[model samples]
Target: MKIGLYFGTFNPIHVGHLTIANHLAEHSDLDQVWFIVTPQSPFKKKSTLLDDHQRLEMVYRATKDYVKLRPSDIEFGLKQPNYTIDTLTYLFEKFPEHEFALIMGEDNLKSFHKWKNYELILENHSIYVYPRLSKGNVETQFSNHPKIFNISAPIMELSSTFIRKEIKAGRNVRPMLSDNVWHYIDEMNFYR
Candidate 1:
């Protein structure tokens, strides 16, 4: 099986995230796209993030109906400041029979070289990059790379940070989030 891993904190799972996953699963060579919910990203600020379990539950609620899109808690058990290289190595060891690929936005690709063991990641795994709004075209170095494939997924300007701000301001964020996720957030009074 060729699984594409889409990693994020998912502070609250939103439609943009789901859309990317759906597009990758449908349009790419991947058999499935797993939403690897990171408890805390090394590059992101931890102050604004929700509790790990809460974020995980939101992911579960949002992805419950999609067979091709599954929510993963693989990073939950791992230590803080999870690194992509370490996660990929662990996944490779545990699921030797399955082929793993990385799913990310073109914006992330711009900073790809800064990631830990990025060269190894490019050599060992395939990467499916979706277009992101506001990000410029792919750089020449990675434009024609064999392991990096550019996908035409819709560019949603929506973001988790924006949604959080809306919720905190008591605004309706229904359009930004999945039905169940919105309901869960409303019921829990999250981000308030």
Candidate 2:
């Protein structure tokens, strides 16, 4: 099976995430889009993120209804401050039968060169990029790369950071999240 790895902290697993993942799963050649919950990302600060299990629960709830979308806690057991290259390598060895691709935003692609062994990752796995409203230009090398596919998915401006801020300010950002995720956050009083 061709699996698209949508890696993120998924602090709350909002609807915008679901939309993009589902779009790629249904429209692209990928059979399944796995939401790999990152315990700690090398690029992100851990201070703002919720507990690993809490975030994973939200992801599980949000993706439960979608056959093509699934939640994974693969990174939780991996080394801290994990890099994409390391994860990809581990995944390839662990799931030799399944073909894995990367699912990321245009914003991430802009800084792709800085990632650990990005060239190696490009050589082995295909990348599926969704549109994101971010600044800066993409590297020329990646512009017409055969392995990189620019998916014409919806440009999701909604961000987990924005949702967290809204919740902290006592604002109802219910529409931004799935009902189950919203209720989970509400019950746990997270980000408040």
Candidate 3:
């Protein structure tokens, strides 16, 4: 089975995220897209992030209605920083019957070189890259390797940071996030 592994902190799963996953499911060769919730990443600043379990719960609530998108906590058992290479390796060993592809954004493309065993990641897993609004006009900016891909995905101006800021400011985030996720956030008093 072809699985698209979408790795993220998913502080609060948003509509933009669901749109990309849905697009990948509909357009790509993959049979399923797993939203792999990272506990933490060395590259990210953790102060602004929600609790890992809460984030994962939000992802689950957001995606529970979608059959094609699966929420995973694989990184919960893995090492800190949650590198893609290690997760892929563990998945391969655990489920030899399945194959996974990485789903990433163009901005992250620049950080590709910083990942652990990046070449090995390229050699083993396929990456489905969606264009980022900030990647500029330069195409294939991180094309040192042939495995890097470019695909057309809806680039929404929205972001988790923006949504969080809105929530902090007592602004309605209903239009930005899924109803289920938004309700959960309110019920739990998240981002306060």
Candidate 4:
């Protein structure tokens, strides 16, 4: 299976996340897109961030309806402050038959070179980058790299920070979230 790993904190999975994952699954050569729920970094504490399971639950609910999109809690089992390279290595070892690729935005692509063992990742896995209205230009080395594919997916401007703030301010941001995710957050009274 060819899987695209869409990694994120997903404080509360929202529609923008679903849209992009679905787009990549349907438009690209990838057979499936996994929303990899990134575990919270123990060093950078944030009270707003939900527990790993809570975030994973939101992801599960948001992606349950999609045939090609699925949720993964793989990172939760790994050591804290894990890097993408670490997760990729683990996945390859655990699922040897599957080919794993990365799904990221142009903003992340700009700093891809800074990642630990980024060269190794580039050599092993393909990177699917979607457009983002970010300020910096991507590094020249990645411009024509065969492993780095610039997918013309929809640019998702929505952010979890903005959604959390809206929920805290008593705004109805229901439309921004998947129905089940919205219900879960509302029931838990998260962010409010």
- The candidate that achieves the highest lDDT relative to the unseen native structure: 2
CA lDDT, every model vs. true structure:
0.90, 0.93, 0.87, 0.90
Candidate 1 worst ten-residue window by lDDT: 132-141
Better of 3 and 4 by TM-score: 4
> Residue 76: error of model 1 in Å?
1.3
TM-score of each: 0.96, 0.97, 0.94, 0.95
lDDT of 1 at 13: 86
lDDT of 2 by residue, 1-192 (tens): 999999999988898999999999999999999999999988788987888999999999999999999999988888998998988889999999999999999888887989899989999999999988766665556989999999999888998999999999999899999999999999999999
* Cα lDDT tens digits for candidate 1, 1-192: 999999999988899999989989998889999999998898888888888889989999998899999988898888788899989988998899989999988888888989999999999999998887753555756888999999988997788999999988988899899999999999999999
Q: Candidate 3 — which residues are off by over 4 angstroms?
A: 135-137, 140-146
Model 3, position 130, has a per-residue lDDT of 88
What lDDT is reached at residue 109 by model 4? 84
lDDT of 1: 0.90
Q: Which of 2 and 3 is ahead in TM-score?
A: 2
- Can you give the lDDT of residue 15 in candidate 3? 96
Task: State model 2's lDDT.
Answer: 0.93
List model 3 lDDT by residue over 1-192, tens digit each.
Answer: 999999998887899999999999988888999999988888788887898899999999999998999999999989787778889999999999999899998878777878889889988888988877783555454675566667788886678988888999999989999999999999999987
How do the residues 21-114 of candidate 4 rate in per-residue lDDT, one tens digit apiece? 9999999999999999988644346566798899999999998889999999999889878899999999999999999999999887877888
Best-to-worst order by TM-score is 2, 1, 4, 3
